[model samples]
Each structure stands twice: as structure tokens, then as C-alpha cells.
Target chain A: MGKVVILGDKAINDGVSAHEEQVSNLDALHGLVNEDLKAVNRVILERMESPVALISQLAGHIIASGGKRLRPMLTLSTAKMCGYTGRRHIDLAACVEFIHTATLLHDDVVDESDLRRGNATANAVWGNKPSVLVGDFLFSRAFQLSVADGSLQVLDILANTSATLAEGEVMQLVTSNDTETSEDAYLEVITAKTAALFASACRLGGLVAERPSQEQDALASFGLNLGIAYQLVDDALDYSAAEKDLGKSIGDDFRDGKITLPVLLAFRRGSLQEREFWKRTMENGEQNENDFSLALNLITKHNSLDDSFDRARHYGSVAKDALGLFKDGPEKHALQDVVNFCINRAH
Target chain B: MGKVVILGDKAINDGVSAHEEQVSNLDALHGLVNEDLKAVNRVILERMESPVALISQLAGHIIASGGKRLRPMLTLSTAKMCGYTGRRHIDLAACVEFIHTATLLHDDVVDESDLRRGNATANAVWGNKPSVLVGDFLFSRAFQLSVADGSLQVLDILANTSATLAEGEVMQLVTSNDTETSEDAYLEVITAKTAALFASACRLGGLVAERPSQEQDALASFGLNLGIAYQLVDDALDYSAAEKDLGKSIGDDFRDGKITLPVLLAFRRGSLQEREFWKRTMENGEQNENDFSLALNLITKHNSLDDSFDRARHYGSVAKDALGLFKDGPEKHALQDVVNFCINRAH
Candidate 1:
């Protein structure tokens, strides 16, 4: 009931506010935290090194791919918003990226994926063995960097998050291609896998700034909801015909037999024949080229993609609401825009 | 020269010392720290758990598969021998094993291994995906456990060791099946991959006891050499006809194309035809049914197995000498015998 109460007017309002329209991308966050982001990049480059040539080569490839550095930016901006001056945030922010990179490398291996961010995956280029071991190397490097920061609290936050991330990935695997997967189970998986790291990154920002516990918790809440919003939009985009019109590729999750939100919603809302179709395509993982088109058509017919966007908006509003704890400032507004930026990708 | 000097008389003195016979196994070390070892086992069981059912099941399978608990025992014995009277050793010992277990899981995936300790590997039982994620989970748990113990020093030791271990694995991968893998390169891999963890485990044991830096260094030195001895003998046993007669499965390393000391030595000492054979079977990974017998013959003819044992004994002697800093006592004696146990497996 407590969490349910927050899903109210913010989720229902469809009108885009002026500020929300203006804040349609991560540019504001980047502008606010640009210098700190550069410092974080420096630390990341410096730490990914090893005597083993392939370790650095494969790690360097994936890391250099065009990621927005959104997660670490959250850490940097949150610390700045708290009005605390410290350099530890740079080191910790790099650590956040390192953890994310490691997860991506291993994820590619687990998914057997060939492309990431429009480039070849490490596993695809270097093979799974090197990718697995290099992921391990980067993972160990993240912990080493954190230990050097000399904060047990920081270590505790990250270590616990890392475990949660792994548990979430395993749960996703267990639930993959199973048509009967509940909304609650999918939420659990995304929250653990995606939101947990986001939460920890923002929490570390506050922690490094020596902010009060209440402020730290507020930032964590903001990050958690934002992450859920971010992933929901990502999943929805895979099925949105508008996204396809914009020349973006679609239907990776569908092809991989991933039982995501739109699929879950469509299956729950579809006819008996549609349910059988889903069972064949997703559960049994039998797909021809036309299956994705048909699947997207059924999803659009059911308004599943639209409903998924609505859900993303709800989490986005909640993410901005958590920013209410801080005073009026550019930092708060930029962070709010980050939430809007995440959701606007769907609109 | 300093290190080479310790490789003197102690290594060459193969006479059966009176105490060496009594210390034929790990019984002495186990008797000294039986209670601590039990507590460590409890911690290991407690920490491997997750809401994800497969994580605990897979972890339990590998952990309960009759490992001698040797790594943790090194931590436990080193702590006790250093006059530590705290309970932190149990938690830290468990952390050591978690790190080891995590490495084993990833190694199996990297190696495409099907068996470990005569039981199916977790990767073999659950597939590579769960095994990979679970390894990540356990690794994170190890860091969390260390953070809870509230010792940055212990965190530093374990974190550095973890990075070294990963680097070692990558280096091994880079050299795998390259019959040109230098003896120096092979040593570097095992030292980084195996000995580094042992060194850190023992160093942490001394650190927990609040011992002086010199004592901690000495303990690390002892563990480092012991780890090298352990792996060397393990590699030798894979080709030893005597060990094959003991009903132990052999030729796994051979089948895997691992470039260990015996293989490297045999390849170096072999004639032109023998070199051709190794390049075909190892570098080309083209082994027939009878190729293993031919390989073993070449190894024996070159005295590779005996030379590997000599290297193991040399490291064992250095390991024993590092204990000279400690007074003669049962804890010290037990640690010494643990070294002997590792070396005696070949004898």
C-alpha cells in the first residue's frame, strides 16, 4: 500500500510540462557534471590496465563504445547537488562504471550477444573465454579501487549491490522465455539487476559527500525509480513502431525469447489464439523473420507498448518526486531532466 | 639472488627427516585448527545462499564435493600460529574459500570443464550461464564479508590478490596451446594465478592478529612458495606414471592443452619429431586416442615429471624456511607439514 500510494497523479498526467519538454535529454546532466565526468573517465582508463594484452584490449573496446556515462554522472551530480566538495566522488564514479562494464561483458557472454551499442561485443570479437576472464579482471579492479578509497560503508554498498545484480541476472535467466512470468517477477528482476546498481551509485555519491543519511536515502530512491523508468522505456522501445520509423532496430528481446513488459502485457491481454502464438514464439523460441512483425502488430493492437510507456512515466514521475527533498537548484532540475530524458526516448 | 639463495640445501636435502614422515599429510594442520575450520565451513554455507534456488544448489554441489579445505586452513592455521585470539579468522577464512570457489566456477566455464574432484562441475551441471553469474555472486559476497569484518587492510590484501588471480588466468589463456610458452611465462602465470591468493590469505591471517609487518611478509612468503609447490606437483601428477597407477585420473591438463612445467620441459627437451608431435596435439589441438600415451612417453623420456617434482620440492623448502621466523611450536610445525603434504602427494 505504501508503494502503491505513490502511483497516482504523476503517472496519470499526460501533458508534457514546459520544463519537461526542455529537459528531453542527458545534455543538462552532462553540462552540470562535465568536468567531474572527465575525471571519472581518466580514472577508468588508468585502472583498466594490466600486463596481459588481451585483458586491456577487450576491456578497452567495450568501455570505449559510445555509452553516455549516465550512471556515473548520476553519482557526480548527486554529490554536487548535496553541496559537498570532495574528490573521492571521481574515484567512486569510475568504480561505478567499471562495475557496469564488467556486467556488460559477462552479460554478452551469457546472452551470447554479438552487438552492443552498434559495435561488436567483446565475447563476439575475443571469444567467451577471454571475455569471461577479462570481466573477472575488471570486476576485481573495481573492488581494488573501492578498497583504495578506504571506506567500509562504500564497500558494503557496492558488494551488496553486486550480489543483488547477479541474483537479478540469474532470476531473469530462470524467468526467460516463460510466458507465465508474473509482472511482479519481472519487476523483481529489473529492480535487482538494473535499479540496484543505480541506487548504489547515487547512494555512494551522497556517502562520499558526507551527506546526512536521509539525503542519501532520498538520492537512492531517486536513482531506483529512474532506473526502473529507464529500463521500461528501453524494453518498450524494442516494440514501438515509432522507434522503428526512426530507423532504430527493434525486437532483440523478442528474438532472444526475453519475456519483457510489452510481451507480458500483450500475452495477458491477448486472445486464446494469441496466447498460443506467444507460447510458440517465446516459450518454445521458434521464430521465423515474420514472427517479430506479427508480434509487434499484436502488441500495438493491445496498446501494450503505450501501456508500458505509461508505466515508465509513473516511475519517471516518482524519480522526480524523490528530488523534492533537495532545494530548488540547477542540480535538482538537471537530475529531474535525466528522468525526463529517459522517458522522452519513448515519446 | 636473495630468493635464489633460499633454493639451496633445504631443496636438495631429500633425506627423510624424522618429523617429515610424521607430517605426511594435512592431519597436523587440521588438528590444530579444527574448530576454526568448522566455523569457516558454517560461514561458507551461510554465505552461498540466495533467493535464486540454483545459486545455492550449484554452489553447494561444488563446495561440498570434498575439497580438503586447504586454502582456508592456511588462513586459519596462519592466524592461530600468529597468536591471534579473535573470531575474525573464521569469517576471513570463509572469504578465502569463496574467492577460491568463485575462481573455480569461472575457470570451469573458461576451460569448458565437465568434472572437478570426480564430480560434475557446476558449469557441467547447471550450464555455463548460471555458473558464471553465481561465481560473480560469490565473489561479491566475499568482498561483503571482508567489509563486514571492518578491516580495510584485509580488504586491500584480498582485492589485490583477486586482480592478480584474474590477470594470471588471462595470461594463461594467452599462452594456452602455444608450445613456445616460455618456462618463465608459465611460472609467471601460476605465481599470479595460484600463489598470489595463498600469499594474501596468509598475509590477512597475520594482519588479523595485528602482527608486525615483517611477520606478515614472512607469512606471505611462506604461503606464496607453498602455492607454487602445490600447483607444480598437481601439474606433475597429471603425467606421472606412478600417480596414474594410484588410480587417479590423469591427462586432463594434457587433454586441455595446458602449458604446464612438464609439457613445457618435454617440448623443450624433445627432438624435432617430438616437437612436431607436441605442436600438432597441443598447438593444433588435434589429439587422437593414443596421442596421450605418446605424450606421456615423451614427458617421461625427458624426465619432465621428475624435474617438475624437483621444482615443487624447491618451493616447498623455501616455504619451510620462511617459517624459521616463527618459534618452534605445534602451529608452526603444522604449517610446515602442510607444505610437506603438498609436496608429498607427488612422492
Candidate 2:
């Protein structure tokens, strides 16, 4: 029997060189999936048009803002890996992107965020009302695409994922600004908010290819772990990355008092003074000019950034293991590279 | 062959007595559909519960705020009138109510209006973030119910209605504060925003009952015209009704600078001085303390309120004519009475 080899601590602990290799791998994967990605982009642009000029203008602004297109890439690459030869994956990939964009619009409104991906958010430019309504339009448009695809299973998964996404957002709202939030509670939030869609997108690959249930479940597991790892890296990067590199200002999570994983780890390892500072700033909203620098010092002192990355590496390994059933191919290698890229991106 | 009788100028000219008769007819129709409505109410309350207390609290506030459950009633009554015997209609009716409530939540956020149905809006009570998110939850939940019903036709109609509703809202946003918006433009907005759902709800009745497509189209036409009439009466009431009677303050449309049919009529009939007044207030949004009363005087002088109701009555007659294909029964009469009630309810 062929044994599945999972990336270990040594692979991740190699640090800068390892991260560079993963970045190059991601670039190669993007090149491999370039044609399918272009089709998905075409689908996205075609679906966003409406007789109402504001909708097209607002939706076009966000859709064209140029995020990594990672979610749709997951859908496209996974479907191709699973031997999906038909055109449905193109539409489904676009549907996944629409769902992501719709959430971003609403998320900006909910977060009252001004800038995203180094640009003014739709809410910031068009005002909250249009952002909220247009977000809804995109969401409806996503479902319209799902129905046109004529897959009850896809509709079921997308519909359930949407509800979970909303529920997860509400869960985050309930847990926001509460310094006492537990790791498990934080995990629950990320699972529902981020991982659910990822899992669904990956599952659609096996589902459309008519793979066995076991294989579909494996794809879903791979996606869920990858999503968790990706979000963990994102939380860690909030404290460690430069403003230009991260595409937004650092300490936004701090300003918003969001209770992310690194904060939780740092808080657990914090000294009495540091803990008190977190309570005052995060819980009581008593932030000041030097607080962000102080926060970095406390996190660095506790090695919380490294610890958070380690946790992400653990999930990344699990994601890698879940792909054991799939045979070797360019598509499979690209998906595996995606897992590594997600874990090492912050470096 | 029995000829279909359509209401005309003489019926509307009867005025108060005709309005009073319509109210009594609506009361009787409500009495007839009470049981199905109760079941739908139960479904709404049941579905609104969530582990997140704020979701249930916020959703329950709006769901129980006691607006006339008119949309659900349309679904239930039409389904029964079309000889539907299954429980799917009950769930579908609940789904329709959910879609309506979801829109109301989003609409309140968009309008930034504090009061709805004589109570604070969910956005007003819980803030806009929760309202926007919870509205999404309800919309998702509506789709969940549609999926559970296992009818692709129902899903198609509801999904399309949702997209059209969002498009209509965006159209309204574009046209807000623009005094030059044409009557055709106004009708287009109302048709997509309000009438599409009504048409869908009544069509669900035929779909669930497995009625012929011709009969379904008739039912849809009935609902479309009724919805147009209902919205016209509502717009006129914003100017002409007392606050206590209307359950909302007068001049809301004026304050928001929404270009409704009454304003359009008044603008068309106004002299140069009156036109300038509208341009200053409605277009430039430069309103003073006496502007609402001035606007009302202009509308009254131009007989715009009466003309708007006349327009409403015209649609009501079309709604009645569409129902002529259905056999005479309590369901049919109640539906016809609903058309009259929609037109005459402003009194």
C-alpha cells in the first residue's frame, strides 16, 4: 500500500525559504488553472448585469476590485482535479465568487469598514443602503445561478452554507469585544463563517464529477481544514504584516476589538499588566496611541504569532492528508500547493 | 356565457359607502382564511428561533409586530381557492411571509426609518448590522423551506422574485429625490418591488394545486393588478390619511423625497410657481416647516389623491376581471374582495 506523506514541522519551520517555495507553487497552480479561472471571471461579469444601472456599477466595482479569487479557484481546481469535464463547474465557480462578494459587501456594512483590499469598499463609496441592497442582489443572483445549474444537491449545499454564514456572522457579533472568549468559541465562529463555504465549494467538485460519497467527504474535509488554516494565518498576519503587504492598515482587528486566535493565545500567555491592558482596550474600548505597539510587544513576548502559525500548519497537514485518495496529476498537485500556500502565505 | 363585471367610475364615485363595503368584505375573507393563517404564523414563530438569543429576539420583534399578514394570506387563500389539499401550501405560505419580513428588515435599513407598523424597526431596535445579517438569515431560511418543499417551480419563482425585488429597490434608490421620474418609471419600480411577490404568491397557489398553466397565469395576473392597486393606495395614503388611521406618520415619502404617483400627478398639474416649489423641495430636498402642508395643498388642489385612487380602482378592476375564469366560491369571492379592499383600504 502507498503511504500518504503529510508535511511535518520541519517543512514549515524552514521559514522564509519554505514560504517562498509555496508562493511559487501557488503561482504555478494559478497558471495551471488560468483558463478555467478566466471562464469563471466571464461568468461573474455576465451575471452581474441588471437593468438598474446602480447595481451594475456597484457590483462591478467590487467584482472588479481584484481579490485573490481564492474561493472560486478552489471550486475550479477541485472540480478539475476530480475529472469534471462539463461546463457546470464554470457556473458553479462563479456562484461561489458571487457568494463571497455578497458576504464582503455585507461584511463591510456590518464592520462599518471603509477600506478593503487597498480600496474603498462599496459601502464606503455608494453608502450603506446601496451596499446592503446590492449585497442582497448579489446573493439572490448566486441562488439564481445555482438554480440554473439544475442541481438540487448544489442548491441544498449553497442554501445551507448561506444560512450558516449568516449564523456565523451573528455568532461573531455576539462574541465581539469580549476578551473572555474561549478558543473553542473562536473556532466555532471561523468554522461556520469561513470553513463552511470552503467545504461546500470543494464538495461541489466531487459531486459534479459524480464521485463516491467518501471522496466527496474527503474533499470537504480538505477544504474545511484549509479554510481554518487560512483564517489562522490571516489573524496572525494582522499583528505581523506591513500595511502595504496586508492591503489594509494593521490593528484593524484591534480597533474593532475583534477576538481573533492570536489575541486569544497572547491573552492566555499574558502577564498581569498585559492582560489588564487587553481588558481595558478590547473589552472596555479604552484604546490609545501606543496600545498597538504594546500589543505587538506582548504578542511577540509570548511567541503567540509562532504558536498561531503552528496551529495553522497542523490544519494544513490535515488538509494534505485528506487528499490521499486522489491520484497524482497537475490538478491534484495544484490543490495540494494551495494548502501549503495558505499556511505559509504570511511569511 | 356569464359576463365578467368590472368595477368602473361609478363604483369609485360611490366613495365612502363603497370603501366601507370593501372593508366588511375583507373582514369576512380574513375570517374564512383564519385557520391556514394561524398555521403559517406558527411556522414563522417556530423558524425564527435560534441559539443566538438576539436573532430570536430581533426576529420575533418584527415577526410579531402585527402588520397585516396580507402576503401570506394571499398565498393561503389562493391555494385553497385553487383546490390545493396538501400541507406544502402551509409551508409555502410561511415561506412567502418570511420573504416579506426579510425585505421589510432590509428596507428599514435602507430607508433608515425608525418606525414601521407603529413600532420601532428591527434596525432601529438592534442596529443596522444585526438587521442586515438577520434579514439574510430569513432570506436563507425562506430558500431552505423552498428546497424542503422539493418543487423546482416554487424555487424558480421565489428566487426570481427575490432578484426582481432587489432590482426594484436599487431602482428606487436611483430614482430617489429625482422629481422628473416618469409615471412609467414609477410603475416599473412598483411592479418589480411589490407586485412581483404578490404575483409569485398567487402563482404558488396554482402551482401547489397542480392547476393548468392558463389558470396559473390568470391567478398571477389577478395578484399583479391587486398588488399595483395596493401600492398606489398606500402611496396616496401617505399624503391623505391621518397618522392614527395609517399606523405611520404622514409625509414620510415627502421627507424621504420619494417620487410617488400622487407627487407625479401634482407636479404635472402644477402652475410655474407650484412647479418651482416642487423643484426646490422634492428635487433639491430643500424643505421647510410648512412644506408638507404646502405639498398636500398642491396635491389636493390638483385632485391628485382622487386621481391616484382612480388609478388604483382601475387596477382593482383588472384584478377582478382576471379572476373571472375561476369558479364561483368563497375563495374566489374573498380574493375579489381582497382586490376591492386593496383599493379602498386608504379610507
lDDT of each: 0.86, 0.84
For residue A327, model 1's alpha carbon misses the true position, in angstroms, by 1.0
**lDDT value for model 1:** 0.86
What's the C-alpha lDDT at position B121 in model 2? 88
Task: Report clashes for each candidate as comma-separated counts.
Answer: 0, 0
- In Å, residue A108's CA in model 1 sits off its true spot by 0.4
TM-score for each candidate, following the candidate numbering: 0.93, 0.93
Candidate 1 ranges with C-alpha deviation above 4 Å: A1-24, B1-24
Specify the CAPRI tier of model 2.
medium
Expressed as tens digits, the lDDT of each residue in A260-335 for candidate 2 is 9878888988878888999999988899998989888888888888899999999999999999999998988888
iRMS values for every prediction? 0.6, 0.7
lDDT of 1 at A59: 88
Which one wins on DockQ? 1
| Candidate 1 per-residue C-alpha lDDT over B2-86 given as tens digits, one digit per residue, 9 for 90 to 100 | 0000121223212122123423456777788888988998999999998999889988998887577788999899999889999
The lDDT of model 2 is 0.84
- DockQ metric, candidate 1: 0.75
